[model samples]
Target: MTIPAPTHQDMLAISERLGLGITEEQSKIYAEVVAKSITTYGPVAEISAEDTPLRPAGGSREHTVPTAEDNRHNAWFVRSSITEKSTGPLAGRTVVVKDSIPVAGLPMIAGSNLFEGYVPDFDAEVVRRVLEAGGTVSGKAHCEYLCFSGASHTNVTGPIRNPWGDGYSTGGSSSGSAALVALGEADMSLGADQAGSIRMPSSFCGIVGLKPTTGLVPYTGIPSLDAEFDHVGPMTADVADNALLLSVLAGPDGIDPRQHGVEPSDYQGALDQGVKGLRIGVLKEGFEVPGTQRAVAERVRAAADVLARLGATVHEVSVPQHRLGLDIWSTIGWTGMTETALRHNGIGIYRDDHYPVSLMEWAHRHGSAIDQAPPSVKLFFVISEYVTKHIGYAGYGRGVNAARVLRGKYDEILKDVDLLLMPTTPMTALPLPDPSSGIEDELRTSHPMAFNTAPFDITHHPALTLPCGPGDNDMPVGLMLVGRHYKEATVYRAAKAYEDTGEGAFRP
Candidate 1:
């Protein structure tokens, strides 16, 4: 369906219903931002003023479903452009960007205090790609601090709340990006997924999140996380949008030394090709870990059934090392965190990298230590090893080799199945429990960590997180479809099939 752009009145109502926290003037300003960045610059101030659209009475679920309605995000280049005269299939579509990456003069915060007033010197590779393809950026998004706050809040910016209920979680690092797309405030959003940042938020917010194979796209001009753990991808309401954005954003830039020889493909057109007669594999082992809500499992299985019904031969398979993925994921993530902690500290790019001083001091004070304990502690030990050891270049080499095994497994898995299906996040959106509450802090609500996300990063394979359904609390659950190294088109085609079958909705 050709969805129309949202009017200012439509946006204020949506912002209220979806908990967007934007004032009507801000909505007007947002559109003005779009006009300021493009060919039409003077029209925003000239537009007639009107009262905010009255909130619809207890809006229906149709209001919740995305319809390409986006107006609140148009200000200050929140995302890429969408206009009548843009370009091909994805031309005239508005796209949103995480503020971390450079988009010409837009401030590239990288979710940190250090770059407090830093605007980008030039467009990041992804931004150039979008512009070249006729897409205009609407505005930049707010992100978690250093994009490290897994619960998706930023001390430097603001929270992107859950669409189901404003009081709940939106899942993050890429927090605002998810909310924008899930609430139909933008057609597509570009976000980074390190330790499931993109997928986690996408799952919670009821949208599609693609955690593309690591290195499939350039990671230059952004703060460095461990190169292996970091990946850039798209978040959208549907596979068509996901594919379109990927087509624009995936490729090598000269500045990205790791980008090497890899290249991505045309994703939007591939969705229409369908996944009939393809081999589909359901990840049987390690998909369900602690806190995997029952509702999540049911929707994933429902999506599997849809794939089978569509003539994709479905088989349940186990990746014995997927368990290793969880363990190594911590090593992968925490080590990157430590490295980021050090990298930012050394460079002194942020405003307050000074205080929170001696993370080593903090680690020593609040360090998790035990004489003898559970298998999970081994992960802590690995982190401790990273903290104590100067893992510099050689340690990195070993980590890369360890991660590549997951890639080898992906190669094997894809040989038999055209794509692998798994749940994106183990549960759905959660309550915003106080992070300071010791009892609440111990709860493990998010389970879609390395078990589902790490492998794709390690293997450099493309994976898409598609909203399958919601749990008991009405928080969204995402079903993930992982494709071969460069075969994102096939995966999107398969995902679109299942998405259309209504398997992506809540089960009774």
Candidate 2:
């Protein structure tokens, strides 16, 4: 590929767009200098154009969009069988990967029409790890459009239904990942979290979802909303399976810049250790969030009490700063999405991480079509653009600083407790938004479920959601256990003890 030099007229147009006020003569001079400077890009373009070893090494596999009968809940985007190893820990297990992550030869729509038919040439690091661990890549699970929603209805494919209830949402943007696991279509699934995407859906569907400490699992090859909050982890039918999957996925890949001093532990090995002597903090703010149903809060509290019975020291703890987490998350999330999704074609710059060049090109080609996106995505665009145009990066800057304070507050509590317990979502699976509802209603269903789960994403803590019991409307209530950074083992230990009581099972 040859680099194109800007013409004098092109320079003038660029100057006008940037409000540089360059004179015609100045534009001509600048064009000449830019043309000379771009000669250096020839080699760079040449290297990029050449085929690299980054492309997955394998024969192409066939994939099919599931029929309505095969995909009753609209959980699977595409079903395919891809197994790279014959024997390993995950042998004979099927793993459904969230559509947000790239799997070579499979279309990664991320539940958005803008990315429709865009097949990645390389596999995300987590996907490759799954294959190597002997897990079958059963399919690509559908998610919310551009992965922007906390509720399942925003998926362009259609609302993903919770297996536990008819006409109910499977909280998103990892909606399909949780549904597939709950439906027994897959033994485990991989899910990404920016704001409660994994844990929220897992809570709604009665499955176990772990959002590992940020960077515990390398995020290379996955498009990031924001490096600070982006996390990819395991969603499984049980805590043991979740722990097993995390062990396989955690650690630095030498490609993701988000990882720093990662410490991978024996996730599965620590499961049987009961919560004896463990100190558990029940977050008061978690239960007090507005819209939190009394039934849901009571269910989570009962689960905490059960832990106390199992020899764990349980006590109420308050992190008042937690109340401000949602605002901070929104500020950073909207601004980051604007920079990464809107301006940069879902591939942010200023990172040394692996770039999905082909995916970025495909997104760029269809970027103009984002206007046809779902209401939730449009809401993100509007707020992000508004903040950027009026508030500038100052809002994001303040958010980052506030996040540090929030993290400190949680850390202070964690010093006296091994894990913090809370509700994964304020409520259980909500009724799916009506398809005929206007944009305001659609937007309303998007993010309210992430109140508790979003906070840990910003704090970079390892948080896991396991089914505690059934709540209102017979929907599964998710009890979230948050651990210190890189301390997923402690979270699993406590969760396993609770699960052993058989109380984590949904018994509606």
- Give all candidates' CA lDDT scores: 0.65, 0.90
All predictions: root-mean-square deviation over Cα? 17.5, 1.4
**lDDT value for model 1:** 0.65
lDDT of 1 by residue, 81-176 (tens): 323236764577777788665565555555555455554444556666766677757767766655665554333444456767776767777877
* Worst lDDT 10-window in candidate 2: 48-57
Error of 1 at 402 (Å): 2.1
TM-score per candidate: 0.72, 0.97
Q: On a 0 to 1 TM-score scale, where does candidate 2 land against the true structure?
A: 0.97
Q: Which candidate ranks first by TM-score, i.e. highest?
A: 2
Per-residue CA lDDT of model 2 for 1-508, tens digit only, reads 4568888899889988989999998988998899889888768866866645354749976789899998899999999999889999999999999999999999889888889878888888888899999999999999988899998887776788888786999999999999999989999999999999999999999999999999899988888888879999999999999999999999988778878788799988899889999999999999988689988999999999999999999999999989889998988898888788888878788887667788888888899988888877877778887877887899998988899999999999999999999999999889888888788788888889988999889999999999998987889999999999999999999999999899779865
Kindly report which residue stretches of model 2 are placed more than 4 angstroms away from their true locations once superposed: 48-55
